[model samples]
Target: MSTEVISQIDVDRTRGDFHYPEQHTFDAGTGLSHATIDYISDVKNEPDWIREFRHKALDVFLSKPMPTNWASKDLENIVFENIRYYLANAQRPTRSWDEVPDDVKRTFERLGIPEQERKFLAGVEAQFDSEAVYSNMKKALGDEGVIFVGSTDGLRDHPEIFKKWFGRVIPTGDNKFSALNSAVFSGGSFIYVPPGVKVKHPLQAYFRINAENFGQFERTLIIADEGSEVMYMEGCTAPKFETATLHSAVVELVALKGAKIQYVTVQNWSANVFNLVTKRAVAHEEAEVKWIDCNIGSRLTMKYPGVILKGRKARGEVISIALANNGQHQDTGAKMIHAADETTSNVISKSISIGQGRATYRGQVHIPKHLKGCKNNTECDALLINSTSRTDTYPAITVRGLGNSVQHEASVSQVSAEQIFYMQQRGLTEAQAMSLSVNGFVNDLVREFPMEYSVELKRLIDLEMEGSVG
Candidate 1:
């Protein structure tokens, strides 16, 4: 399939220059000590059980050795004692955006959060550094049985619902990073829609990292009740830094019988970040789950959103896009497991690499022997901007059922210098021309995003392409 082209719009190139709040200094002190964990727990007034959970997780993090075989090698350089565990510029989240600290509000305004919320979002949560500062839900949405807020708030206010599902999908012992997130995780979104309720607009959460040696571990859980539908979006940005920051998060989603859920993420971290995240969902009878993920601008990113089709007639789809610029590595894909009859899945992945960057897709699709009528289709495409860049696709598909149908396809291509030379001859500067071609390479998957976000994604791609020409 060809990539979709995005129409050029008048953009405020100056807007990217808007400054954000400085990292809260007092919270910048390092070391993963018991005292630090206690401070975080006390500040949030968390339950005793959670404090103990953090301590247990810290032990696991300290004892566990970094996996040597994974796509990430930079993770070995992380000094556990050199990172700050928690930070908060605001003691509590404000219901009204204006009530948020002026500097914090300015940060969101810089990112166009307010404008996006006003124009298209049903709800918006803004988190800076380590804590959610502003969370607002449209009254009409709140009135219709929707719960949208930070994970901390969810634990405090809705303990019954929150406790039941927290870590249920991805337990602390699932993996090293997942355990770490369970221990010190804070400031993520928890959303639930009542049975049969369908949200008209997307809900979004924006995460910004303002500190130098900080690790942001946010935990998000989304549950769609029977016959319900909900769409959630997440975006991230961090300023340029010399030292790498760690962002390892765990996201779990559950789609009940006849329900649907779509999770979208657009990450544009600076090159000084190791973005390792775990996201998975469970779909019941006749339910559907989709993951739309875009990854760019991180030193190393390892994320593969997965889904388990647990009941008959369930379906899952994952559409992903990644771009790796100089010194960056984008390692991401998806997983689909069929557990019942008549389940279906599809995975479409696209990646672009430039200036010695590397991109890889690692994915799996499994259908057990008892799962009859299972079907799956997988496609992976890679684009190389320069000869020095690299890309790879590794897919493992297992079909055990007699009637299962599975197909896998992969293609890799390099942008011909002729394409750029052609565009340059059309009156476009070299940078603009290369940007247009790279944008064209990934536009089809980006079009799946909301109009506003699609525009932002293209602009970010363009910004990364600047100075890319040799």
Candidate 2:
């Protein structure tokens, strides 16, 4: 929603098309149980509190039921006992690229991470399977009291800062998947910017899933101290496996007084992957938190990035783009809770459904009677590319506060057959004509994406159209 643009997405369509042989030194065997919990805690040498926390979360996961809504029926297909909870090849992440294992380095090389790190990013972490193979930050940032590393390292090394806000924004009982992620979480990132420090370049992480019937649960936490600012971008990918793969991640962000945090996600999972994630942020007085998200490929995706405006004049925003292909369902949206006076929130979402795909936008905004001068604006737009494709929008906005105001707008349209035929008559193929039409439909939102990623998104949409229309 903000004009602060992120850098080019290093990984794209070809990023996870190939996978190397699996050679994990550590693998928590299939199934979930207390033994699995013990194994994970033992392997990480976690503190007793963390171990206890995991046990509590697992109990919550078991006690809770899968969502019963129509949008969640597909979730029943996931066999929890059949999924491997964790797998990793390394104990500690390497800071230098030369120190990284050849196989791990090769995996990152294919994603263009090294080049991107050198060109645009201030720091980078490349997570493979359940652990980070490489994690590094520029020295200038470290000198300026910035802490950037894997969540594991964050928990063990900087407990003072990490423990303060960890799991505070989004609790374990937020949902079943969240509880599940909290129980078996690994990798992801932890970033802390000291007061008044503004990171000049964005930090980035790439999560790659390389095993079949395996689940990757990465946990991320970011805290910007008073008057500080930071932007983080993450990309996820998994090879196309015949058996299903599960990716469930949890992200929590905290922005202190007058601070700012921008989070960007580019997800491109394979067709056999289920991408379910929970992300939320807390914005303190005069602080701001924004989520820039894009979803492309997955069998099913259910994610809603939310923010709680906890202090006066706080702001929250989300700008999202989701494209669903054949046999895929994209269920995505945002949530905003205004708890203080004069808070503001905005959401702009655009989605495209191709072939027999389905896309749904579900959002929520709440302002209690105690608040005053709170405002919210939400817009959801969808484009369908085929007769059988489908789209839906659900917005739940409650404005009970004195002088509070809310605005919501939603629209759905289909590709014009006449326009496609006319473009075809001008010598363009069906896919080309379809690409032009789809681009025309989403260009406004694409312009809001980062420069190179905007181009990459356009290309990805064209590729999807080719598969559906050609």
lDDT of each: 0.87, 0.91
Error of 1 at 195 (Å): 0.5
lDDT of residue 170 for candidate 2: 85
lDDT for residue 289 in candidate 1, whole number 0-100: 99
Show the lowest summed lDDT stretch of 10 residues, model 2: 1-10
TM per candidate comes to 0.94, 0.96
Looking at candidate 1, what is the lDDT of residue 293?
97
Clashing pairs in 2: none
- lDDT at 210 for candidate 2? 87
Collision pairs in model 1: 4-444
Q: On residues 31-85, what C-alpha lDDT tens digit does candidate 2 reach at each position? A: 9998999999999999998999999999999999997763568899999999999
Q: Where does model 1 exceed 4 Å of error? A: 1-28
lDDT of 1 by residue, 1-470 (tens): 12222211222432322335464633735877767778888878999888898888878766776766555766778777888878787657898887988887877887789999999999999988788998999899889889999999998998888888878888787778988888788888999898999998999999988777889999999989999999999999877678778999999999999999999899988788889899999999999999999997678999999999999999999999999988989999999989999999999999999889999999999999977899999999999988899998889888995999999999999888798799889999888987898888888888888888899889888877875875
